[model samples]
Target: MNQSFPKAEKLKSKKHIERLFAEGKSISKFPLRLVYLKTGLPEETRIQAAVSASKRNFKKAVDRNRIKRLLREAYRLNKYRITEETDASYAFMILYLGREIPEYEKIDHKMKQLLALFLEKETGKKI
Candidate 1:
């Protein structure tokens, strides 16, 4: 309802992100790969995510950072849907696997679609 992305909702931790990738279940739908695992926190529902552009595809750190920003923004906007629907806490990492950087609008659309798919996969029901 606020329509603003807040800092409290963000997922930021190098160790946690790594653990999510290490121990989580993964789902891929081209250009987007989602890895998630349940968390032990009682009241706090936290998400840890990252968007990766392979060095083989993008040689510049600036390009990689830009794409990661776009992906993070898209995820930030749609994450409320995930928070609203699920009671179980989770930690997630989303990887970008495309050969080229996509436009922000396209990335945003894909982010929504992927979030829905992930919710459905985890809950066995449409969101």
Candidate 2:
């Protein structure tokens, strides 16, 4: 499977981000929270995602950046499981709600669980 997160798949539009938070539905798995919105995207990609680390939790820019990187990596590896069957496009914002640094293994596992939860709730199908 092609498991790459290209620039086209990153959520960067300010207008879209505003609309998403204003109108999106969210699911949480402890330190991770996923906010999703169903919308029409011009790109051919089925989903576009963005990750955030709370500045309140991690004071330094480096720490927040590292967490965002880890979150993105985990999503890139696991997104294929969700994208395979869905025909409609969506926007996703993954937020890290932890107060401290995290291990990659924990992040990866939580990411899988989070994605499973998203799939279950959105499509009524277990992954």
Candidate 3:
């Protein structure tokens, strides 16, 4: 078990994220929102994660990028749990909906909790 989320496992397209939001089911556990949809792939999954702290909150792109980086790092650490529990292929988009950027530790904690919630909701199993 690698327990690592590689680039190949990441969802990369804006179009794909848009489609997931349009047709997929959504669950929000504050600060983290999960948008997921079934995919045609044979038991393969992909994830895309983002954080927003742009002009809406911070006026600097640097601030936005830093927040996004934290969110991505958090997701990358915990995605293995999701991959192990689900047999159905899925495309997931995780959005951060917070007014302020958080520390890495805080974001990581929330990521794990959110992923666990998503797994429980989707599979009825606690991982």
Number of the top lDDT candidate: 2
TM-scores, in order shown? 0.85, 0.97, 0.83
Better of 1 and 3 by lDDT: 1
Clashing pairs in 3: none
Give the residue spans of candidate 2 off by over 4 A.
none
Best by TM-score: 2
lDDT of 2 by residue, 1-127 (tens): 8899999999999999999999999999989999999989775788999999988889999999999999999999999988885777999999999998999999999999999998888888897
- Global lDDT of model 2: 0.93
| Local accuracy of candidate 3 as per-residue lDDT tens digits, 20-100 | 879999887777787888877544444444444446776678877888888777877787887678767788777777778
Where does model 3 exceed 4 Å of error? 42-55
Q: Quantify all predictions' global Cα lDDT against the true fold.
A: 0.77, 0.93, 0.75
Model 2 misses residue 116 by how many Å?
0.6
lDDT of 2 at 34: 97
lDDT of 1 by residue, 1-127 (tens): 3345455445577777778878989887778888888876447545545556677888999888988898888887888888788888887777888988789998888888888998899888786
Better of 1 and 3 by TM-score: 1
Candidate 3 minimal-lDDT segment of 10 residues: 42-51
Name the regions of candidate 1 deviating beyond 4 angstroms. Answer: 2-10
Q: Please give the TM-score that candidate 2 achieves against the real structure.
A: 0.97
Clashes of each: 0, 0, 0
